[model samples]
Target: MTGNTLGLDKILNALFTPYKERVPDVNKITQAMVAKGLINDDSEILNDHIAFRTLGVPHLGIASFEKIFLHYGYKKKSSYVFDKKKLDAFWYEPPYSHYPRIFLSELRVSDLSKQAQNIISKYTSSIITDPVDAIDLNDYEKVGSFFYKPLWKLPSKEDYLLLLKESEYAAWVIYNRYYLNHYTISVHELPGQYSKLENFNTFLESIGITLNTSGGIVKTSKDGLLKQSSSVAKIIKAKFANDEEHMISGSYVEFAERLVLPEFKSIPKKKLTKEHRRDGFESANADKIFESTYLEQTTKNIN
Candidate 1:
């Protein structure tokens, strides 16, 4: 979505490759959409945005992770704080309208209990410099590989469980550093019947997709202009530092619908464009959407 179109494509491919493998729901949902004529191919579905989770520590977190996208012409936008969840996040606007927006969030390590902080710091403390700063951002291959690179040694299972008991977000970063947390699909871009989230959610459920039911099936903004839903993260068996293995929550896929802004409501349906629709995310909606990776949602019994 910038002058470096070819470069961005390569980098995005790198990020999505592993995410797709880890989150099979992605291919499952996309393939189902194809059967229902929702899209011709994978590329037709608009990626509303992609999210990243980080540990808020020196030389890491948003300040460092964002450098990659920002270098590709993504501009930082709104800031959000989740007091209860102990998170701080910002959404970035893409250089071109076609590019997916970026959502970057960090666990507020200082807000956690002393014990929890120590668990996270054990691994992250060794990052003495912003690793992104050392790389040539212009080198697409290097930048692409950076997302999957481990910033520090893996944490022991005991440390991971201790962190999980305090903050699930912390435990995730300790193992899944810089991994693409979730990528969203713009449901508003689907066919008329499936363009609405409620209808789309039904379609999702029909294919055996378990949705995150934190606040409700549909997480709506106060203004009701933006609505979102996400799949419960799949449980992946992880082999920890000491050869201990356990099934843990992994990345998920999200679906979003952005209604036409009140000011642009009069635009003809046939002529409507993204510029005519509501933009950006809603904190209240996001607050619940974050639960996709949470244990309650992921471990909820499917009916």
Candidate 2:
């Protein structure tokens, strides 16, 4: 599309432009997308990030990330590399303004091997003062860290997954915020090493957890993986419940109730008006008040 097209091409160009001076060719872009299973054919137009959505489950999402790194022969921590100047800018400033940013949540790695440390230190000038501080450490003693860096120097899947498993909640928040609803999943291209849905379910059962796929919307049930099991399903479910309740009350009902009520002081007087004026109003008001109060109390209790 030559960076001039109206649709996907334009989005791709914008995403790639910051790094274009590095001038990653069509082959590099296609290879990355293919490794991530973002596209079926390498020859297909390298377009929008939404193209990533076609991949199902862990395929086009976090699972595909491992393949992307392996394809480049980059070891998790051992091959870590980034632009020191760019990283310094992010560390010293608010993350919102950083250029070519890569935001990875709860990246866990315990006892980074010497090889890994050396690789990471090469590109990032930040020194590890405390051994424990180098990796992410969650409240439950999970080892992981959230990182924001240049896209060109993002970490590998092994490192990212370790972080995710250790701090599952944080990992999910990151995935939901950045990956979910944004990327597509390609079910057919899932890695051979990945477990099947049945196997995943078995693992969940062994851990005394049950996945609720009752509604038949797989993504909500399995976090979009058809064949694989999510280690974070329980955590994701909790998040989903909280989010669903918030959306229904905050967006769906709040405005309607607000529109119906004038002020509590006005309600009693309005009810005292002539029979014609108050005909159905009192009953309607009572119902609305009951519903609104119920929702507000439920939200407060949950919060």
Candidate 3:
């Protein structure tokens, strides 16, 4: 898909197109959010990060999916493990200061039950080689197209539910392979009333967006620097193997607002600086946000 190196903004717009098509609320909510904050245009709002889920098997994992972002000048930042959820993730930093960070997580297939493992392996086994290794990293369009490309066949409806019972994340990636799980909005960049997550959340609720409250309406870090919230996934009709169709939960969009660390308060308001603003993903906050796609949460909020 690449003829020459494309600009970062162009790449992002192309990447977000399909996601916005599926979750129309993103465009609506974002536009309204900027208006509430009294921002003159949508360009003023900053995105914190975008996250994706993958199956940790032979040909598909962070190692395979991460090449696209890495080719776009993103570097690995931190690693996190969710033992209870059987998941591992890492956040990547961008080459430019203005670009959004990338957070990626993969389900540990080996940790699942025998039946679940077999179901997962049955599909990914076809990918005998690492696909990312074959991509031309210098080709931006080629790398961008790789994000939506399907590496394996669809899962059977019966096998899908079985995996869901044991691992919600696993079921998600199995069906929604290479889809953008969520895009985070940097609310810290908003104006006065909407600068804090608490207020911004209230604004979101007023507009009829149901958020993931697994941890709480607002999830905060121990230090109170990072706060996150996500709308429940919008369930849409998905066609599985054997031509069976059912309405299943798809991806959701996430909103995050970061605050300056206590020590950084010494700087003047105008002089506080971008360095003062909190950066990176919080393991605690992210852990709960991941529940946005759980069956229990999406069942009530099908859209």
1-303: candidate 2 lDDT, tens digit per residue:
111113222332343343232222223434544665545654343111121111112112233333222222222321111221111100011112111112121222223345543433332333223222333321211211111122123434443344344332222222332222111122222233212334324433454333223222122211221221111111111123223311211100110001112233355533522221101111122122222212223243242
Please write out the lDDT profile of model 1 over residues 120-230, one tens digit for every residue. Answer: 788878788889999988899999999999889978999989888888888888999889999999999888899999999999999999999999989999888999999
Q: Give lDDT: candidate 1, residue 271.
A: 90
C-alpha positional error of residue 259 in candidate 3 after TM-score superposition, expressed in Å:
0.9
lDDT of each: 0.90, 0.25, 0.83
Query: Could you tell me the lDDT of residue 258 within candidate 3?
Result: 78
Candidate 2 residue runs with Cα over 4 Å from true position: 1-103, 126-303
RMSD of 1: 1.4
- TM-score, each model? 0.97, 0.18, 0.94
Candidate 2 Cα deviation (angstroms), residue 228 = 12
Task: Give the worst 10-residue stretch by lDDT in candidate 3.
Answer: 1-10
